[model samples]
Target: MDYLDLKYTPKEDIVCTFILKGKEDKKTLSSKIAGESSTGTWTKVLYSKKELNAKVFSINKDTIKIAYPLELFEKGNIPQLLSSVAGNIFGMRGIDKLILRDIDFPKKYVEAFKGPELGISEIRKKTGIKERPIVGTIFKPKLGMSPKQMAENAYLVFSAGLDFAKDDENLSNQDFCKFKERFNLITKVLDKVENERGRRPIYAINITAPYDEMVKRAEFAKENNGNCIMVDAITLGFSSLQSLLSKKWGMLIHCHRAMHGAITRSRDFGISMLVFAKLLRLTGVTELHTGTVVGKMEGSKEEVVEINNFLRKEWFNIKPIFPTASGGLHPVLMPELIKILGKDLMITSGGGIWGHEMGAASGAKAMLQAVDAGVKNIPINEYARTHKELESAIKSWKGFEKENYNYKIKH
Candidate 1:
């Protein structure tokens, strides 16, 4: 059956753009993609409906845009939606490579799901950090930290003017640090910090587990006065995320994209990080880890900028997500990060803090000072001249200037 409709314009359909490379002709491959994703078989089906077929309405060389009828998807069901569009088409024969570059959901479909409960502005209000980028850190030596050690570190950073802290992606209920024990200790430390400093910093406790267990952990956190939770969004699956968001706990959901590189790093195959970011926003994550362009991440400056913009831009009733810049970040790179990503961001560092020459507290001070310099548009070197913590941090961590990363934001 012919799937291409050059004259068609998609109004209410879920439009997807894909890049396909195959031995079969472009027309044939595009037809197969539309058919297999929607409602066609290898042999002519005994019964079929023309209205259900996906329409390949636009094509430019190897790039094609296929629009699926909104009726094909169940309301607010991401698993079914992904299965229909992103599934089955990958393993098809004769197709050498395929990439799902981007997707656009109609207003009707987009409004069906609940987006972030507390988006960027609300989060800033809650944290009371208005102008500067929110500064945070991941616990270094991701695994094997005892509960006491973890709580002590939390106390150090939270008291040192850091706005946020999170458990590393791999940290979850190890023998050395049982979940309940760690939660108890950290919450106590946070309470102590709030009492002493008059500001309560956010601690994103990892509650990523099996669905039922995850729910139980979330309940535990809620019962014990926890304000935020983190999930490895990809590994936990979108269904779980939807269910968790549906609970309306009103807590900040920090999404850690741990295994995204496997799918997003490849240029010739698999899905794009942009698609993942959109879906996460739709599923209601308060904050997500978009790449740090100047840091040690796979995404380029342009790609990272695009993803960050999409996360924070207006979409129907969906609130803007706080784009988190993480992975190999340090105090030295603060100016470059704030310049490229803007001030509405969460800058997280791990080794950048804990690996400091003095200690974690000093490192936190240095990071905050660097952010202050960046916000005031002062040269870090010039600012460092008077700030002892920043000067020490610069002495310890150098070489960010040599990367020479640059980007010009488009109006």
Candidate 2:
């Protein structure tokens, strides 16, 4: 089967960027990969077709771009599209190392999937926060807390001026802190906070489960007056996230990248988190976890900024999703994070908030203060002068500088 078509450009085609490293010649291996992913094989079958194969649009040194016809993919199916473009091509014997960098989705195929229900504007409007990055705090202890205990902790953070209080990615409908019971308690806390401070804080209840059960959990959240729901898009899969969006429950869908490091952490193999962010956005997640440059994650400042820009940009009329900078975030790093990502972001802290010397409430206060300082262009040291929480936070964890710059994992 023939795959190269330098002069051909389909009306609507899925473009993929790949880094090819192998023992065989680049052109030969590249064509073989394009064919293997699309409609070609080592040995021709009885019914051999040529026009239906993917075309190698261009090749630049070790980088190659392949375009697959839009008709080759289902209208709104992500798993099916992945099976074709990212399937058996990786295991090919000729290629020693292959990395799927990014995909330039065609407008026709992009419009097929439902984009975010509540994007950045909707989120800010709903929460009554017009500017500055929305701040969220994850319940520390991760698990083993009772429903009552978690709700009380959430109240502390929400009442202390944080915009969001979310469950950790691993927290599901566990028997220890049942989903129904936790939702009930958190809703009550939200009502109290609204009645007092008139702040419309949101709680992103974790609904990571089987399809049917996940739907049930989302329904329960809506019924309990919960404003948002969280899903582990990596482990639960984007297909399941699409199913959740189809229900049109009207709650903000927060996507957590719990297990994405396994695939995106590698520099020479697997896929990039940026690609995952785009696919998840198309599948209709209101907010997504994009790594923080100053955090413990492996993403560099350049990569993190690029992912944020792509998620928030207007792409084929698809709505923008808020880029959530999480994972080892703290008060000291807020000014720097804001400088890098800007105000149209959701910043969450786990140990950053909960690890404060004063308490979770003070930790929450410190985070907000940092955001205020960042937005007002005030130095953190000056901002900490008046705010006791910020002062305490700086006294505890100093130097927001990232430690050790290495792509490959050490452990």
Candidate 3:
């Protein structure tokens, strides 16, 4: 099979400023290579003794950018063609950093990877949810549950019919709850759900270990029959995640932006989570947290949608990823969550399950009912006929009004 080409023959405006520490060789590095046409616009400049800058309107920025069609490189071989673009020169020996700054994506480069396996439509269809989004629950407080108890709770949610379930980001290697033990315990319940109820819920087990251990954890989940693996992608670093994908583990890579706000929270500075979303997608993660539009997070509805849009957009070989909305989520907020982000989403509620009046089983049922309501575009209150817990809860809170709408969805 031939490898995908990415020689950066950008079809749009692209200005790249590489802020570096090595000596800038203007005379040698300022030369521009011709693209498919000798008649195209390709300009290069070496400035500031440590910066390399280039400009191309509507250009591709994957591996290398070509002002003209990079098809001119070697007719095909992308890696070799790109390597030849830079040529063999001094090659910054002592460089401490290399920053891409910015790359304007052309129409073709916009999509290279086929984003998600079960993307927006497929996931919705598979889940049998149309207008409404899938609602999920996480096992929170990290640890202290015995393997049997964990399995029991998982069975509760599984039987209740919730769509997605996950372990908290920090739930790993607790003395009281061994990872393999818990994994084996939960898989039994999930397997039973599949055999009895035909419900295939996604279990996102957190694998937030340091670089070395992280790989082991990812392998562990796949080896233990896990549907997906969750990771604090921000905590593990971009390159770390890249190495994992290189091995083609290819399970659902759920990314938790645990520390992303430190850089993305400020509107006027740093980079947006949207940018990181693209980079992580490049390295091949499956599902990413988009925060809740209606749950207990700081981002507005528009922000969550913006991130989801980028994740689902089509451009090049980049495949779309699932947009997981979480953070203080509950069954009651399902309708609004789907409206803002669409059915190509993952909904996660935590304490909302354990705090329910009838325990995790009923809470999961309530969440599933709310999902049904969203997909069918029905009101949550109206869904109660099929979902008793949901109807009961909605009846109590339906008439109550909060000036700021800060009511918690738990009993």
**lDDT top scorer:** 1
Writing each residue's lDDT as its tens digit, candidate 3 over 255-276 gives: 8888888756753233456656
> Against the correct fold, how does model 2 do in TM-score?
0.96
lDDT of 1 by residue, 1-411 (tens): 467787889989999999999998888899999999999878786678889889999889999999999999998999999999999999899988899999999999999988999999999999999999999999987998999999999988889999999999988887989999999999999899999999888989999999999999999998998989999999999999899888887789999999999898887789999999999999999999989988877788898899999998999999998999998888899988899999999989997888777899999999999999999999999999998888998987777442433322211
Q: In model 2, which runs have C-alpha deviations exceeding 4 angstroms?
A: 404-411
The global C-alpha lDDT for each of the candidates, from Candidate 1 onward, is: 0.90, 0.88, 0.61
Cα lDDT tens digits, model 2, 1-411, are 278877777567899999888998877888898899988888879775676789887888989899887767888999998898899998888678898899998888888977887788888888888989989988988999999999899889989988998999889878899988898988999999999898878899999999999988888888778899999999998678788887787889988999888988887789988889889989889999998899888798889999999999998868998999998888999988999999999999988898888999999999999999999999999999999999999987786446843333322
Q: Supply the TM-score for candidate 1.
A: 0.96
The TM-score between candidate 3 and the true structure equals: 0.71
- Candidate 2 vs candidate 3, lDDT winner: 2
